[model samples]
Structures are given as C-alpha cells and as structure tokens.
Target: MRVNQAALDVIPEARPPGRARPLAALRHRNYRLYWTGQCISVIGTWMQSVAQAWLVLELTDSAFLLGLVGAAQFAPILLFSLIGGVIADRVPKQRLIILTQSLMMVLALILGILVVTKTVRYEHVVVLAFLMGSLNAVDMPARQSFIIELVGKDDLMNGIALHASLFNAARVVGPALAGLLIARFGLAVCFLINAASYVPVVVQLLRIRLREPRPATGGAVWRDIAGGLRYIR
Candidate 1:
C-alpha cells in the first residue's frame, strides 16, 4: 500500500498529484460497516482507558503505581505478540477478533460491576488490565491483517489510512468525554458504556459473510517464530 507516497525518501515517486481523494474507501459496504463499527468501539475503548487511569489514581495516588499499572496492561503485548501473531495466522481472523472482543467485553463488564459496587481493589484493576492486554496482543495483529479482506487490494491503502484517522480522532475526543462522564456519573458508567459499545462491532462481525479462508500451514510456535526470524535475516 502506497500510503503517503509523496513522503520524502525511498520507493517510487509520488502519485503524479491529485490522485488521492477523500473517503474513497467508504464506497465498499463491508469496509464501511467494519470501519463504522470500529470507530464506535475504539472511542469507547479510549473512554474506558481514561476512566481506568482515573480509577487507578483514585485507588493508589502514586505516579509510580500508575505507571506500573500501565506497564502491566501492555506487558502481555510486549511478551506475547509474536506468538499471538502465529496464532492469528492459524485461525480465521474474524473468528479470532470475535472471540477476543467478547472476552474484552466481559472483562469490561466485570470491572464496571466491581467499581459500581465499591468492591474494586487495586489488585483487581491490575489483574483485569493484564487480561485485557493479553487479548489485545492477539487481536491487534489479526485486526490489521483483516483490513485487506474488507477493502481488497485496490482500496487497501485508503482503507488503512482511514482506519488510522478514525483511531486518532477517537483518541483525542474519547478522553475528553471520559473526563466529563467520570466527573458526573463516575468510572463504572464509563466502563459499562464501553461494554455496550462493543455491541455494534459484534453485530457487524456476525453480519459479515466470509468465504472459507485458506488453512494455515505451520507446526509448533517455536518453529514459526524461528521461520519468521530467518525470513528477516
């Protein structure tokens, strides 16, 4: 995909100018539905992230502890993403995302209930963070790979760009909304709302009719990891 082909350095010259247009990728119904659902879900995800941070501060009140919590959330991604990528290659991407998203929704609901009932402990927050991060490790790679299936090679570049734009827009706006909601209704409401936001994405996932994917050919996680490294070398 020639994203920002005009950028300085490397590869082919810029598109002879005026080739790019706005929202060209939205023409595909599947991409549109997927993108819209993802937008809603991503915004809610950001909201929960902000609310979770606030909850951590309230519970611990230490910047170091807060940093530790953040690290705990991403540690799984750092440690498991390579193996997760191998797992993604062996499963249907849509099915993988559906299962991971379901897990995430359940985790969010649990946290919300804990917070609302005044039973949330710091340990609970850390443990849930770790669990959610574990899901994200697998979900992230598959989600990226699945984009081409939605828009195909023709619109692949545009689809990828639009996805990034949606994510950044949500990141900017979601935190502000989270702050307001937390100020008024509190963290539990934010988590609960995020859980609800997953509904649209799940609905879209089920609506998608995927042809049978090619079976993944590989044996053993370590062998796959070694093959990946050898390819890089």
Candidate 2:
C-alpha cells in the first residue's frame, strides 16, 4: 500500500465529538522509540546543515559558490528519487537507515576533523556535501515509508504527522544551537556534535526487532523504478 493510504487505513474516525488525542501514535512502542531517536538525530542534522552553509561562506565568500553547494547536494536527489523509492521498497528499512545514518555520521566526523586541524578547504566541503546528498537521496524515501512499519495501519497518519512535527521542531532548535556553538568555539564542534548525535539512532536501530521482509521481484532495476512511478501515478 502507498504510505498515505496505509496511514489512512488506521486513522481513527474523526472525533466522536470529544477532544482529540493527537499524540495517540506515541502509544505504539516501536513508533515511540523511533520518534525519540529521530528527535535527537534530526536536531544534529540541522546543526550540520547550518554549519555547512557557514563553512562554505567562510571558505569562499561567494553567494554563487553557496548556490553551487546547494545544487550539488540536491542534484543527485533530483536525478534519483524514483530509484531511491524502489530501493527502499526492496531493502529492510531499519537496516538501510542504520547504514545511511552511520555513513552520514562518518562524513560529518571527517569534516569536523579537517576543520579542527585547520586543513579544510572549499573543495572538501563541496565533495562532502555531494556525498551527503547522494546518501540522502536514498535515506529520505526509506525514512518516509518506514513509518508504516513502525506504527502499522492503525496509527499511520498520526505517526507521519508526529514525524513532521519532530522534524520542524528540530529544525528550529538545531540551527539556533549550532549558531551559538559556532560563534563560541568553531564550526568543527557543530560537525562533531552532529556525529555524536547519530549514536542514539544507530543503537536504537540495533534494538528494534523487525521481521525480515520478502524480497521484491519486478523485472530489472529500471523496470522496478518504472513500476513505482506507475504505482504512484
């Protein structure tokens, strides 16, 4: 089922004339655990986002270069989102997320080290952002679809809404916190903190007990992508 339809299936009947309990999705054990992990991880992610932008400006002092950084990061996503969704369907979501999150943490740490040691250059930031974008192209679709696995059909919409709330909250807090840290210490600390933040999520993924999914078969990879598009359409 499409994730939206999956969630709608579980949606409680629109209020029986009583105050609604919007946070009802948190009642699910898996979703609660996943939500908690994401709350921490996304905050770190935003910190990294802000720090990266600032680092780019510091290195090059050009708005055009900053735009290039943004484009480079998203170009892969623009090209590969369809393929990413197909891959997410084929792979176990939690395992894929764990791998992607770990890779991101490592990338952040590498940049952190370079910044701290005073060896970082503009080229390094561009290269790293491109790497991050490539990972994100896969990571995002898997993540969005994985909510159903966490909360099932009964609380899918609530789970998705809560997830968005968590992300928005993190976006607000992360950038503010990163700004403070960047001003006081340096950009490297933001990156390091982001790296450390991934631990909770990785550990959480390990703790999750999910059944292995049956392998998907839909002709070749290109065919799978086309099928997903047709399904979405």
Candidate 3:
C-alpha cells in the first residue's frame, strides 16, 4: 500500500533552520519507548565498560592489559561484523536484539557476582570480554536495522542521527557514573546496575507491535558479502 504523500509532507523535519530540537524522534510512541529504553541501556553499557576497564587495571596494573581487554571486547566486530550484517538482514531484528540483550545481561550478572564474591580473575574478565564482544557483533547490526524498521524510510536519517546522539550523550554520563560507583561501592555495583538496565530495553522490545519484513533468503554468505561490497564499490 502506498503511504500518503500529503501526510508525509505534514510531518515536520527533525531539524529546523537555526534552533536545535533534540528528541524530535520521541514524538512517535514506538520510537519514544525505544529512545528512552536505549538511553538507559546505553548508559549502563558504558558504565560496565568503565568498570571493566578499571577492574582490569586493578588486577593487572598494566596499560597493555587494559588495551588488550578493550581489543578483546571489540575483536568480534573486526572478525564477524559482515556476517552479523547478513544475520541481521535475514532475521527478525527485534528478536535478534532481545536475544543478544539477554545474553549481555547474563554476562554482566556473572561478572557482577564474581566480583562481589571476590572470585573474579583477569582470565575470567578476558573470557567474558570476548563473549560480550561476540554478542555485540550481532547486536549492533540488529539494532541498526531495527531503527529503520521503527521509523521507516522517510525518517531513517533522522533516526540514525538521533541514535548516535543518544549514544554520545550516554558515553558522557555512563563513565562518570561508573567511576563514582566504582570508587565508592566497587565494580560489582556497576556490573549489577548494568545488568538491571537491560530489563527496560528488553521490555520495550517485547512491547513494540510492528512486524518487520524479513529479507529474502537463499543466498550464500560470501556471495551476499560480495554483493554488498560490489554495490558499495
């Protein structure tokens, strides 16, 4: 069915000439729920990042190990990001996100419990960092695809920019909060709080009523990757 062009015309552009209006996407109910939940979740994710880095430093007392920890956390993206894009295209993005988010929660909870019990070691941190990074490899694409589904084509650019803004805003707040909690209470608190933050996003994912259309199936992975590359080239 064709969407109404008149209605499209009526929808305001997210950015006006001089004055800035942040949170314009929050005007839509689904996007609003998604925005708020993601805001909280991103902050928690950043908090965990800061806590994890500090925890690694505490254990190893080496900048190299800290860098290693960071690399392990993102290594999966370098290895599997293209595959993740394929999976995101083939699967229901929302369902993929829910699964990944749940896995992240579990990882955070495990780390939190380990720290609280004084049983966490550098090895455990390395393993968990890799696991979380693997999950993120898939989760990031699912999330990017899901935003397009939430706002549709016309507002997609606005949606992506808004999402980036939310991420940067959280980046500023999450680490500071994590540092405070780490200094006062301990790393366990940061991990536990990060685990708790996933709940709202999971709930919001479950609540979204729209059904995203599935991508066409029956392509080999390498062929699909090549096709994407060729298209871009």
Model 1 whole-model lDDT (C-alpha atoms): 0.85
- Show where candidate 2 strays beyond 4 Å: 1-20, 231-233
Question: For model 3, how does the per-residue alpha-carbon lDDT over 148-196 read when each residue is reduced to its tens digit?
Answer: 6677665677788999998999999999999898889988999999999
lDDT of 1 by residue, 151-180 (tens): 666668888999999999999989999999
Q: What is the C-alpha RMSD of each candidate to the true structure, in Å?
A: 7.1, 5.2, 4.0
Sort by TM-score, best first.
Answer: 2, 1, 3
Task: State the displacement of the C-alpha of residue 88, model 3, in Å, after optimal TM-score superposition.
Answer: 0.3
Q: Candidate 3: list runs displaced more than 4 Å.
A: 1-24
lDDT (CA) per prediction: 0.85, 0.86, 0.85
Query: Candidate 2 residues 1-233, lDDT tens each?
Result: 43544344334555456565699788666677788888888999999999999999999999999999999899989888888888898888888999999999999999999999999998999899999999999999999998888777767888899999999999899999999999999899999999999999888777666555668765688988887778879
Candidate 3 positional error at 50, Å: 0.8
Worst 10 residues of 1 by lDDT: 5-14
**Model 3: colliding residue pairs:** none
Report lDDT (Cα) of residue 104, candidate 2.
93
